[model samples]
Target: MLNLFSRNKQLLDEEIINWIFDSYDWAFKQFDPSVFFEETELVLPTNQYFPGEQNSINGMANLIFEQVKQHAGMTHWPTKLLNVTESEHQPVNPATLSVKGQLRGKQAQASFELGSSVEALSEDTKPTETKPAVTKATSTKTTSIKNNAFDESEYSTDLNLVMSAGHASEPNTGNNSINFSFHPQQLNSPEGLIAHFAQGLAQHLVSAAENPPPGGKEYLPVATELMGIFMGFGVIFANSAVVPRQGGCGGCGGGQSPVRQVVLNQDEATYALALFCCLKGIEKKQVVKHLKKHLRGLFKLALKDCERRLKQESRLSLSFAS
Candidate 1:
């Protein structure tokens, strides 16, 4: 998965991370995913700052930015705009406060503020209690998933797809889980998954916006996997859904836009889907013990934020049934 998500292609800015959590918070309030599966359109309360849109999930990238800005309370955030405040805050020397230096400093600070939330989350998720050693069963599962190689060939056209619901309690007094998996494929590799990222995002977003995929009898389990991949660490799951891809940067990059270069070919999208299935198991793995402290902060903030959202919502049956 690290190989798939790959190198430093711009860090997920702090604000974007916050928005992701907020989206989770919103979904949690409606029910940890009942609403996600039930409704195609996502809406949020309107306020002076971030008035979420009627179709927040699948809108044109530019328009969504306005909604995100409003929600982040950073509507005044600059776009191709600059301010003067050289590196030292107060220019190292009054004479050094040239327009260029001042602008650079301000720009740096502005960018820092933008990513504050992500850093905060990273800090908060840091480990507190020491984690127990990985049990043999857990280690075995990890090895099996990673060692399974993809079927790469000219004739390998079919994806090995499986979807089924867990057996319900015979008494009908318990819930069941859904499981879906695909035979490992080339696209699940570092090179292939990276190649399909852009196209997969375009397809997913467009499908979500213009025409949602048919659900039929397979909806619940499939939807659960999608939500988990998206909400969890998102290594294999960070679809174009990335804020920058949504045009969140202050200014557009020059030269041919990457979006224009990639043709949204169906083959590529299909490949990505296969990879998504193989990567779906990432959600269940526990964080590595050594790195748990670093991630604890993120877990903490996400929980705190969800709790806030839950508080705003009416109490659900489970909360008060006792």
Candidate 2:
């Protein structure tokens, strides 16, 4: 069903792949390798389409996905996830006022205080009608951001609404699988993607703590590992179609070119990785070197695949010979 000639299809596939890689990379970085290397066996479902099969585009797609799984996998998350909570404190204060007014025949007066504090924590007695009631509240929100820092609370009256709305939409919890997705727009926001991935890690921590899978290990922060993941993903899919588009220049009056290579230059790709690392809370010089080091064999593999695809396409004339 995938046709490269169809521009829309190509774009959609590219867009989906881009986000998948980002999420996979993030999830992988948070994974602890010890779980995978443990004595237990990891039985990955076997259903990959072999790219070498004759006229099998599905095989190629499956191969690409498998490569991504291999490239992105790192550790086994615990059955439970860590707890990262955000608390809101809404403190309301009100002072009552009384006023008397004269009517045409009889004097009438009414006064009331709106938004009076509702003290729910203290065991104090209520005051008389002459004084206004007051309430006090203290709250906290803890999450694994900026090195598990304690950030400000966003308290509100509708705690449920605020809690659910502040974070990204969660995946279905009924199924025993880690599944999440992103809109094309969200892929552009590395910060949001990182946050969502952190939420996933929190889920894993909670699962681990609650279930305690066999040989499950303690959870720890892996900022550097995350950075390395970004580097790998950025370098591998630097030309992500999901990134926001800017003005593109061709001839002022000319029509579109039949073939256009919109790939980023080397320097541009490098800069993009650096920007992502800075955003992800890693701004060290070694980041780039680490990417280069891990990427030593990437170009070679890419070249081989390109050559094979070129040969395959050249030999095919739409269908197999009778």
Candidate 3:
């Protein structure tokens, strides 16, 4: 009975566990191992990680995008290739018009009427002065940085790897530019926006792969979410996975329901986060406080499970030889 209980106590099932492990291994093979072992820091949802205030919504979104890109280890990614715009549905504001005609002259009056009509059309076509909402940075040059620690032969052979700013270059995606449309509601929760940006960037990385992840097409979304976790944004992802909605009126009998934002559920995200902490040798005390109150217990269990699994398999250990 005790053994059965122990077996059932596992946080994730065997298939999910294998998939996570396989994904991590594949990531190590694709990108630099130092990213998982040394370079990538466990990002937290705090002012220390994201600082600065942009009064306008567009400015805040831009700031978050840049920070997420940096944390995902893609600072070398050309800013010109990406565009960020707010998704809004607003009614068209038509301009008012008034026309007056006088029956006094002949050809000259007709020509004057034509000229007035043309001027009115031009005035109507003039662009309106609205608040800046779309944020996109343009540059003619792409910067590349070289790292002595990176090994060329070890990574994927399908695409040419250009070492850039201590990380890999942004994947070449044909002619289409990457665009992120964020809802204005996201500004209320910066963590969710960070998770969204991380996942978006991760999708770009996943697209560059020669082959699909372990489960192939069907699991692509899951793999993309995991890729975000693998990119060191696990904390933000886990925290933003499920957010409680504001309750409605008491008489209406409406209760609070959590909004599911990411593909991974709370437990899965926390487990993946634990896997990250385990491989990176991050202690519980370092990351536990940042997680939600309800998730702290599960995180502890996940940490223990990850530690046990890693002990059984020595491949993920980090013991450098002298």
Best by TM-score: 3
Per-residue alpha-carbon lDDT of candidate 3 for residues 151-207, written as tens digits (9 for 90 to 100) = 223211111112223322233233222334455455555566677777766764664
Q: Each model's TM-score?
A: 0.22, 0.21, 0.64
- True-vs-predicted CA distance for residue 89, candidate 1, Å: 51
How would you encode candidate 1's per-residue C-alpha lDDT over 137-249 as one tens digit per residue? Answer: 10100001221112222111122112123331111111111000111232133222222222222222222221222242233223322332332213222221111223233
The C-alpha local distance difference test score for the whole of candidate 2 amounts to 0.26
Assess the local accuracy of residue 217 in candidate 1 as a C-alpha lDDT between 0 and 100. 22
TM-score for candidate 1, residues paired by index:
0.22
Positional deviation of residue 238's Cα in model 3 after best superposition, in angstroms: 0.9
Q: How many backbone clashes does candidate 1 have?
A: 16
Best-fitting candidate, scored by lDDT: 3
Where model 3 places Cα greater than 4 Å from the true spot, the runs are: 1-8, 79-177, 247-261, 314-322
State residue 289's C-alpha deviation in candidate 2, in Å.
16
Can you write out model 2's per-residue Cα lDDT over 1-322, one digit (the tens) per residue? 7676855222123333243234323333333323222311211111121112212222222223233333333122111111111113322223211112210011112222234334211101110111122211111100211111111121111101011113232222332222222222222222223333322223223222222222232321222222223323443222221222233221122231111111333223334343343333333433333232323233333333323433454322121121
CA deviation > 4 Å runs, candidate 2: 1-54, 74-231, 241-272, 275-322
